[model samples]
Target: MRAAVYIRVSTDDQVKHGYSLAEQREACCSRARILGAQEVTVFSDEGISGSTLERPGLNEMREAAREGRFQLLVVRDPDRLSRKLAHQLLITDELEKCGIKLEFLDFDWKDTPEGRLFYSIRGAIAEYEREKIRDRMGRGKEQKARQGGIPINFDVFGYQYDPETGKVSYLEHEKKVVVEIFNWFTSEDIGANGIAKRLNENGIPTRRRAGRWHRQVVKQILANTVYIGLWRFKGMYIKVPPIIDENTFYRAQEKLKEVRRLYAGKQKHGYLLSGLITCADCGNTMTGAYARWWGKRERRYTCNKTCQGYKNEGCRPVKYILADALEEAVWNQIQTWLMDPDRLAREAMGQIVGQNDPREQIMVINKHLASIEKGQEALIDVIAKGYLDHMDSIEKKLAELKRRKEKLEKRKEELLLAYRQREELFAKIDEIREISESILRRLDDLAFTEKRSLVRALVKQVIVSGRGVPGGNGLRFINVTVLAKIPEQKISS
Candidate 1:
């Protein structure tokens, strides 16, 4: 009979209880040999958490057992098998299915009923330990949350709060990204799907830490009051770090509340462009309103302005587009944009071409730094030669040169950071292009106001100036201003 020995030692086990790897391996191997086994194969899971099913060595041993490489399996104790009862039961069922007899050096399951009971009790004790540990960790997190520090389940982005020290710190670049999303959604009146599609197109990772972004993530970002300095823990407000200004945040919330009110008690109201359309004439946003007519669904973008003073004032006629037709037009535009892949690639490459070479810039700055040092030394030398008449001028010149040198060195560092970002973007150029094409394709499939939402993502503002297109009847020229890539600016309020 061939025997396989499995051993596991967690970080906590090694430190607190001294469950050393060498001792476990020695005991398991000795016991397997003593059990009249012809061959012994040892499997060790070191520095692995027993709570998770990611143990490498344990997986290999289980595979070997299934292949009939070992007829008997030995462990130092039942705890070595697993810390969780459910996991232990699963392992036992798998071993049984493979017709492999599991053995514990401290347990004699095949010998007597008393031994079986002892093994069961030992497994229970291990399970209790794991539960205790889990409970302690959960309690610690709850305590931190109660003390005005956000509980760290890690879903919240933009800023990280250390529960131990209660020190809230922001990842500068990531925070800016979040702010951009918020601004794009509310101010630009972009829908959740459109925002998510644009973000995915720009190679932004999704909320699930997966390869793609989802509309739900966009919704969460829009509804998250935490960005404006309100921290929520388990659905209750706790601690927060101020990100956006209070006024802007309140306005965003107000818009969100209005959107919710508009869609209340209606099924199928969660359309892509539900909350983003604005009135071109009255300057009020067009809220989504629907009515059943002749057993057919009719959707209209109604201006929030109730007074119709301009109705008879000979103003530009309000053009109300059918939701479906609007969505179709937007989709057609997206399809046209993505059909030429070569153009998109060229456009992407053009953005990074004029960036300064960080290495050359650093070298130039270093030369200036050396010259400053030399100038300081020369000034000291002249002062030491008893020529103190122009000493003050020389000193001032040296100070100015030193400051300029410092500024250049700092600028070089900034250039290095920009270069690193360009390098990363270049590496993912192909992936970025593919993502962009996919986003355009997806946007082209949305209906009505949904299409308008896709437009809102790329556009900052759409001003309808009550001006009609040339040679067209009452068709107003919609002036669209796009929100292209811009250098990040720090916003402190």
Candidate 2:
């Protein structure tokens, strides 16, 4: 008779009960030899959970039994096959169909109805015992947490855990890494994606030390309250040792929100008229799109939701304009304005005639920025002077002030941009002519990025209104009306 012996144990079982894989294997093989088997094959799954049926050894054993590699399958216990009663019954039934005898050292096995009922009860009791043990462990951890002990596994990246003392402290090198991550995120203008790219380029190892850094990982580090000594456990934030200051941590959080808000719906691709073109009918912006057909690429501007399966019920029909044609039309207008600088300047001035000069707003923003800077300096000065008792309240106040300062700084940049554009509108005819001619010289050779910048600077909104007409070649021809930013005006005689 041929016999197969299977053994299994989990990491916790090995450590807590000294149930080593070698010990199980030795015991199972010995028991199989005593059961009148001349041939024996060993299949063992080490340090794997019996809760899951996806073990490699278990799969191989099942396949072997089907192939008649062994006449009997032996395991030390029913729980060794599975801790779940359903899984135990499933494996036994499959083995019976395969004509392979199933035997366990700790439980009796029989094919009779009464024997099957006893087997099921034994499996159920095993599962219930496992569940009871899980419940006890969970309650133990919760009680530990309530008593101000660390309830987590304590394998956090930058910290080292002392199992004997139940204490956690920073590993020096990893602690430095944590500080650098926070510093780079808060101080640099780059977002989490840019930081992740830099980290990967610098060959920085991730927490697992096997994978490269990712944007989400970097973001998680920034948003983790642990760096600021607040470790959240089941909605309760417990105190931990601080690595990043509250000021820097809160600033990074604010920056995360600002980045998401400001960069949402922004097209990063260099589409010349991306945010400039609008469908007059649907009021939706027509963005740049491309398709590959028959080994050739076609680029066009399209109302995305209407054509892209978003199923906009109101937009019954869709409209698309060739990228090349619309870009050429808009570029030609830009060139015409460039050749006649005085008329361009006049149109620019006319557009802003009623709007107030942005310089006054710029001045006010600068004053507020300066006041915030002064406040920041004062807080630093107080910290430098060793005022330590109320540091928590002081840090919170400083973080709030910094958040306000960031808002003001962002507004100042906007105002400054407007001020620069207003300055361009007021350029002298001679300067405009010189600059325009110089730009027009390289107009044809401009890169896509440069052309995009030029379009965004000059064109405010391009409204497209047209209907499609079927052409003779089984194609559609789209004719659209363009409402230019600078309408053609007859010069004063």
Task: Assess the local accuracy of residue 402 in candidate 2 as a C-alpha lDDT between 0 and 100.
Answer: 64
How would you encode candidate 1's per-residue C-alpha lDDT over 299-380 as one tens digit per residue? Answer: 6444533231222222235444344433333334445445664554566677777766677887887888888889888888
Q: In TM-score terms, which candidate is top?
A: 2
Clash pairs for candidate 1: 323-448, 327-448, 331-444
Q: List the residue pairs that clash in candidate 2.
A: none
- After superposition, which runs of candidate 1 have C-alpha atoms over 4 Å from their true positions? 18-23, 44-48, 52-68, 86-102, 105-110, 150-155, 162-164, 197-214, 260-493
Whole-model alpha-carbon lDDT for candidate 1: 0.66
Task: Output the worst ten-in-a-row residue range by lDDT, candidate 2.
Answer: 306-315
Error (Å) of candidate 1 at residue 37 is 3.0
